[model samples]
Target chain A: MNLRRLIVIGIPFTWLLLFFLVPFAIVIKISLSDPAIAIPPYSPTLELSGGWAGLKAFFSQLDFENFTFLTLDPLYYTAYLSSLKIATISTLLTLGVAFPMAYGMARAPEEWRATLMMLVILPFWTSFLIRVYSWMGILGKEGFLNMILLWLGIIDEPLTILNTNTAVYIGIVYTYLPFMILPIYSTLEKLDLSLIEAAEDLGCTRTSAFWLVTVPLSVPGVVAGCFLVFIPALGEFVIPSLLGGSDTLMIGKVLWEEFFSNRDWPVASAVAVILLAILIIPIILFQRNQQKQLEGDQ
Target chain B: MKKLSWFNLTTLTLGFAFLYIPMIVLIVYSFNGGRLVTVWAGFSTKWYGTLFHNEAFLDAAWVTIRVAVATATLATILGTLAGYVLVRGGRFWGRTLFSGMAYAPLVMPDVILGLSLLLLFKVMFGSMGMTTIILAHTTFAMCYVSVVVSSRLLSFDKSLEEAASDLGATPFDTFMSVTLPIIFPAVLSGWLLAFTLSLDDLVIASFVTGPGATTLPIKIYSAVRLGVSPEINALSTIMIGIVTVGVLTASLINKRKVVQRLKDEKTAN
Candidate 1:
């Protein structure tokens, strides 16, 4: 029994320790270390052969220079702020688009609900890169939207939608819509239909009952869905990089450019540390919400 | 029978249409004869032919499949074990930390994960390549698999395992026979999810991949960054087709299994 227990728990536990947990520790250590011009990029590799003085030297050498650099750079600050704003707005947009559809799916005849759920999940199974890439053709100046508008005689010239923040918003909402919809749909599906009837029977109109009951009950789903969308979208690199223009400022892109474009490992690690710090609250809330949902499921 | 009010119908239609139209447009334009991507031209299968002949794209795709397969297998094993431990291993040391590590990667942004892994690999392995990419993919993908499998195990009928235990089967034997069969479907779904994630990864792969080890998504990303091309459209169309078929087939099999189980329960009762 002990042997079985060890193998079952120890294998995965060790793997996570080595890979997931250890990597973040390395990131933190590297973030404190200084950038180097040598191979492997970061410097002051701690040497134990020289004993206590070497350790002291290493500790003294470790500095927050990279983190201070981050504070000094307006670019990083702006990118962080913009990423938050973009994530917020896109999450709200996803909620608006997904809630009604989730409602529709939940209210549909029972037989159709399964199929509708599959429809939402289908895109999730497909390559996310391809889904995001699909919008390029449609949102381009001479793309389908413009072509249709011109054919309808709405305008003589095509509007420039690609290479803009607006395009990022569209891509985010489109991509993350499923995440928002599924949770809301699950909550709505479990909703007691008799509650609505009871509300209507007790001098409430359909609209009033919906507003008071359906919307309020779905709040848990909404909150869960928002965190689901907001967390990833805040740190999004692909959508903003592909769709947004030069003016677009997102911390994920900044971190990518810092590491790859500028080859500054320490700085990139510092940026990542900060990003993770900001994400901690939302992540904790999300964890709590999911736990609550799981307990409710039980 | 209650019919959907027009509001629900309109919203559902519009919602699905919004979700689907972009891909449909890409599929339609993949056959365009002209060099331009957006404009309509004479339909042609030439681009698809061109895609088949592209050696670079083909090599990247092969690499992607190999990485995906390896990542999926490793992730499924580890994830299933993690799920089992979480659901049935009883309280153990560091359970909270273990569960946190297991679930954190699901929401972790790819860039930070990619960056952190790159930093670690540079320190430990010194050279990032296919091996490192697989390791990185498995690290995160296993988290997703654990979530799926553990959720299934959460709802599992535990009395079956207890029955096996009471019948004088060892705990290990009971787990292997009684528990494994019941959780097989969730385990399979987790494997599929991990496989798809590895296949679709670009960001993490980009961070860990060395020269000559580029995956398909990275190749496609660079190509797309160069601007939209008909060849890419053709590639995407094929990818979309594969995913559609895979998902539909999986769902159908699942549906059949559910029906069969229901029938079996009726007979047993």
Candidate 2:
């Protein structure tokens, strides 16, 4: 039995190690190599003397250069901060919209619950890229929104809604809203109604009972939803790239440019390492909280 | 009961409208005759005709289908295995590591994941192309599939497998005959999820795909960068139509099962 268990576990472990872990290790190693101008830095064969010198140079070069450049450089820091700000704002907005929707689903008639849940997830099946692009048609200068507004005499001029920060926020929130809703809905679905009934029987108003009982009970789902939104939003590339204007510089776009346009692999890796570090704490907390919830249920 | 208060009804109607209006507009405008994406110049199927003839778009679509299918299959297999182990196997050396590896891709930012994969390809494989895109997508796609499959595994009955094993069948035979059938639905769902993710992926594909290996999303992105046109709208309309049909079908099937299970419970009681 033990050997069977080991074999079962070992297959996935070996697969992940070979494909996932080793690849990441190679990335870190390549980041430490010198960028060759005439040839690609990643040569199939390592030049013996050049490799030793490159290793030494890599170690010596690993100072505050990349970090300082990322921080002190106005463009870099601005992009990093703006990306965080957008992601944070979008996450909060999604939570605001999704909370009420989830609560409504939870409280709705049992017959309607599944249909409502389907409504919430229906948008998710569509291509994410297509959904993001659809926003352009709705928010562009001559797009549907503007046309409708003009017909209604709401505004004389078309709104400059496309390719802006607002557009980026809208795109991010729209894409991630389902992620926020499902977890919260699952938690709310499993919530014991008797607890609420008890609170009410004790003379707690619906509002007070919701705050004092339901809200506290759904903390795990809230955390899961937030982490789900925040982590991916932080590194979101597609929305910001397609909808965001020049002003909407994000870390993901920066990393893309560094690797593809600038051919700066080392700096991109450094940036990635930093992003990974930023994500570690929240991910660990979210996972721990989720595990505890699972154990509690079990 | 408030008996459907006006405010609640209004919110529900408006929320659905907000979700559906943009999609409707995209669908309607796909038939627009003019090049202008916004203005509906008397309905025509020219854009659909145009879409058919656009070899570039067709090629990208083909590439996307290939990638999605391959990633879905590979991720589903690996994920089913990982899910089985995580839910049913005993804790041992490297179990934690395996779990971490499986879950790590979920939390990692797409940018970081894409960049890391790009660097890996450059260092080890010396090329950025379709294979890299497939590898990067499968990395996270497998994680998602594993999570979904594992949740299903958790609720599964262990005794059925034991019963089968005791009935003079080998473990493999028992798994094939008993376990596989029970988990097949979960595996199918996992595959669908993986397929959608692989198809929707843009950031990772952008970082990994070479010049000739652009996918549909990449093509649409580049076209949008130049300018939005009815052609893109036409493409989106078709894609959204397919997705909507798929989602509605799945939900209908799920609802039927739920109702059947409820009836069974009530009958037992």
Candidate 3:
């Protein structure tokens, strides 16, 4: 490549390498090292000045202690499993809500589709923290939901929804709803109406036609949407912290508490490393779906 | 066109309501005269005034804006360049790794990104605060910007750029005079997205920020952690209003541009 090309590509490449990629190396290194009370918060710093001897010493000191510790602690394992469960259930709920809406948008009159799409995208322009925080008012013990329910005589007392798993589910579904809708809408919009017509002509009922043709075809969008929601919901910090009770055991919350409350940087790093390792399968699958879509478009 | 089905209509209405009700409540209650969040009193703008007078909130707001603007501009530049290189540059060494890096941050969790970036910053600069926050935001925000810009580029009319260069303009001249203008909307949206991402960030900012460099989200987080406050509701209302206005105006501009393009195409034909 020419000088200009080199400079253009080199800048982002170098930046990502420095800021995005290399950081994981540090985390992995820190996770294996012992925690310290000193500056930088971890021990056995690689002494590059002593070159080969320093490298040897650092390598020799590195152990699987942190990873092992993670296994021994039931809290860590429970947090991991709980995060996955929450993410999975929330993804399904988002899909249930979003699919119909997306279908509606896809089937809307041509002029109205843009407006509907804009409405969905508008909430995202606002702060995510604000949106999640907004629910606190409605779900609180003395909040609007309870007041309305009590006034209607639906319940004698308020239902405890805030600071619970249900609240986390609501936050996840609400915040990530757009991610689910947009992808599904795009795929459904491009669906060939003729296929449904053909199916009907071949003796399939309307609902059956939708099931066999429309639903089957929209699977790609559904998968994409699910992964989009599931991946972030798995690692979600703000939602669980704000909405979940103290007993809720999300890995993100656990990691945060480990680093901040306990000041155990190494253990936190190990949690993060393991989290990323688990995410690899889903990430790779998402990447493949995207690649296939691109190729199919071409 | 097929008529809308009742089932579809019902869902669309319910879905939008679910999406909007919490925010509408939040905005409406921001004007509540009472200090208690759930209590409805006479409508008042007192909370907005209170938000303005709060020195800590104002300081954090200013810091947040500075971080956002810088992050947006830097992210746009880097992201635009990266998108251009990826789409047009083509077939470079380690292209797979480059593409993987570009996309990975999008799916990566905020906590991990924040933690790892913090560790990196400590080892490199041993520094924290405004610069660290900006760098951290830019790193992730640029990845998002790249996705937006690259998607725009993917379906771009490359022949226009090719035509400009074919007329003997230099590549840089062709890009500046032709490609940039054509993709300006995408670039603008990318900047806006980056700006908002930085403004909205709480997890990453908390991780990388050091003493005396609290951003608005971090400030809001700390406040809300105590309990919902009227001042925060007023602040959120302002943010929602700004975002709503910005998004509506952008959509209007985009729609108008599309109309004008179609009109021009008709006349040319």
Query: Model 2's chain B TM-score?
Result: 0.90
C-alpha TM-score for every candidate: 0.98, 0.93, 0.98
Question: Would you list the rank order by TM-score, best first?
Answer: 3, 1, 2
Q: List the residue pairs that clash in candidate 1.
A: none
Query: A97-177 in candidate 3: lDDT tens per residue?
Result: 999999999999998999999999999888999999999999999887899999999999799999999999999999999
- Per-candidate clashes come to 0, 0, 0
True contacts kept of each: 0.77, 0.56, 0.86
Best by lDDT: 3
Model 2: runs farther than 4 Å from truth? A1-7, A42-64, B1-7, B257-269
lDDT of 3 by residue, B1-269 (tens): 77888998999999999999999999999999999998888999999998889999999999999999999999999999888877887899989889889989999999999999999999899989999999999999998899888888888888998899889999999989998997888999999999999999999999999998999999999999977888889999999999999999988988898999999999999
Docking class of 2: medium
The list of candidate 3 runs beyond 4 A from truth reads none
- Show the colliding residue pairs in model 2: none
Stretches of candidate 1 exceeding 4 Å from the true structure: B261-269
How far does residue B251 in candidate 3 sit from its true spot (Å)?
1.0
